[model samples]
Target: MTPTAAPVLIVEDDRNVLDITSFVLESAGYPVLTAMNAEEALLVLAGHPEVGLILTDVNMPGQMDGIDLVRRLRESGNPVRCVVVSGDALHAADRLGDLAPFLAKPYDRRSLLGAVQAALVA
Candidate 1:
């Protein structure tokens, strides 16, 4: 564990998953930030510069989608690593883009934590 546990930002429109994921990360010893969409995510990221990882869904109801969020994050030269999880397999390839270690939805707890660890470690 780090002296200051890395903040993991979880962006998901689904309220259940958002809360569950936040709880998962929190229990795993990672600081977690929850957002319903890209707009809210941006607001959270703006204040907490310690954010070291992102776990987002592909489809979200907001001004910017998860792919756009990751792309924009990269465009801004932020080092925060990303893990895009979605139920849509067809869109995964395109949406994942340069972001590696993507997970399909309904992911197991181990897989989720593994992905988070990899992203944060990266």
Candidate 2:
């Protein structure tokens, strides 16, 4: 799917990260939806069927982290794609496996945009 085909839901607890991510995606011409945590992300997911991708922070402060959120979505057969962003890149693969691409924190603009584009297309 193209980046603009559907809105990208960004799940981040950090205010600055959320703002930066949203700005970057918006500037890149992709529509964005923001959620401060996993619960909010789930709520947004329930409300917005047009969402195509979920870009989430791995270590969010909620009943479920990003990994858990993605797993839940998978278990429920949600087809929406996802990308997990985290500072701890080492364990991301083991924790998330093939569920989604893992983007390390401090990712550059080009890398972030590339990952998002790849995820959307995949």
On lDDT, the candidate that comes out on top is: 2
Candidate 1 lDDT: 0.83
In order, candidate lDDTs are: 0.83, 0.91
Clashing pairs in 2: none
- Model 1 per-residue lDDT tens digits across residues 12-91: 99999988888888887888888889888889999998888888888999778888888888889887788888888668
User: With candidate 2 superimposed using the best TM-score fit, by how many Å does residue 95's alpha carbon deviate from the native?
Assistant: 0.7
Q: Which ten residues in a row have the lowest lDDT in candidate 2?
A: 1-10
